[model samples]
Target: MSSYRIIGLFALLGGLTACERPTPPLAAGQEPAYDLTSYLQEQTARLQQEQPPVLKSVITKGQPTETLQLEELDWEKELAIFQEVDLSRPALRDFYREERHTLPNGSTVSIFTKDAEAAAPVDRLQLTVSPLQKLERLEAVVLEENLLFYSKRNISLTAEPGSGNLNGYRVEGVQKLIFGDSLRYRVDANL
Candidate 1:
């Protein structure tokens, strides 16, 4: 092969190889302000420590119209329901790709995207941890591009993993999903 043709082939191969590599969350010489994964593990353990009262609410158009005391469901069943929507478990976290960023106020934001599952609508999860490793915010969203044309049942639960306080931690869960005929359900709980 001519030198130019050989160079072109090598360039094509390099591009293909680069596409196979997963991007790192941090830039060169940069470290995350908080240990998000470890913090999640700690939160999970704390939530499992005691059975806290769960306040369940249903909201429509950003306003709560219905409220229920979910103590009737019990903690074990409630946690099992939460695990179905929240993939904070380390084993399930393996399926997600993590990225971290440092905010101007010095807090760290860690995002985990489960892009591998094309069928699910809500796959992106984010957690904002304070400089002290305190979870301040948690969010999960459904990327519009990933929305299925037909109907999809996507449930997401949000919770603060572990708080650095004598009062211990709190567990909050949210379940949002679409069933048959495009019916949508939004359920939020604080335990």
Candidate 2:
């Protein structure tokens, strides 16, 4: 190749590299908080490795409650909704306000409430940790509204107080689309 062509290619490559933005680190040191994404990821990995049987019950508007006992589950897919509410992202560092409280029962609670003006879907997240810092329960509310559709989800997860192993989870939500009737659904799963 000609020397000029080689130099131009290098310049183009450098420009392309400069245009690419790397994902910012989740921890920004400005806030002391629990890493929700990492914690959920660890739980997902553990569940997948264990392959525990799950009893799941689902109900949808206008439908009968259906129950299933499954020997295996796609843990990643099942936990996708929880993962979507990641509060640890750098971009969300300032989106939610954190409050810490100590209960009379010797548990600590961390609550993150999103700013009213923030565009993030995660509206609120509350986590209860035992005195030893093990997660006991998590509750979250997520809202998504746009021109075409609207959805609100309330999620709750419970873990064994001593083992910190997830024992059950429930998700309840309502969804509606423009010109359509609202639909409500609920899913409860026990491990």
Candidate 3:
């Protein structure tokens, strides 16, 4: 083959490989778990394609509540905090204790609590799945504390009952820094 042709072929192959999605790391001997990263990525793609209108409200300490109707949104930016609660990281494989229970309404709940000795930001994750195996809701609590600052966030996402589409989401949190006043805020959005 000609040198130029070979170089072009190599470049094409590299470009193709770069287009492929990277797989999340998994621990040895561990059963396949829900891929929160991929799930959120898919949701972001779907929302981008659908371009749904969102009703959003924001409240801050000592401030009046602000409401807005948004026709366009940066889904990934909005969900960045939720993505930080990913529990499937290889480092956190055995850090969380998992529990499953079935409710009388035929829904199943799975709870993952971070082990006390494990140094992780996500404190807890709770998921509710319907009888049909569709995700009904997801809730997560994240806490970070250090010598300089401390913050906690309670986040929740709800899916439409039958369609399993994202219906709404809420994030409420408080943050305090050394020598700074505490800040509290809440954000709610409906699609």
Highest lDDT, which number?
2
**RMSD, every candidate, angstroms:** 9.2, 4.6, 8.4
Candidate 1 segments whose C-alpha is farther than 4 A from its true place: 1-45, 59-65, 72-99, 112-122, 142-180
Per-residue lDDT of model 3, residues 1-191, tens digit only: 69999999999999999997566454565444456787788789999888899999999999999999999999999888878887767667677887778899998788989999989999999988788867789999999999999999999999986766788999999999999999999999999
Superposition TM-score, candidate 3 onto the true structure: 0.80
lDDT (C-alpha) at residue 46 in model 3 = 96
Q: After superposition, how far is residue 151 of candidate 2 from its true place, in Å?
A: 0.4
Best model per TM-score: 2
Ranked by TM-score, the better of candidates 1 and 2 is: 2
Full-model lDDT, candidate 3: 0.86
Put down candidate 1 lDDT per residue, 1-191, tens digits, no spaces.
69999999999999998887464344576553334445444545655575455667765445556877643444344434324335444344446667888899887777778767644444766766677767676566653332333422333344443554212222333333334233345556665
Q: Name the better of 2 and 3 by TM-score.
A: 2
Q: After aligning candidate 2 to the native by TM-score, how far in Å is the CA of 188 from where it should be?
A: 0.2
TM-score for candidate 2 = 0.82
Question: Ranking under lDDT, best-scoring first?
Answer: 2, 3, 1
Model 2 misses residue 28 by how many Å? 14
lDDT of 3 at 165: 74
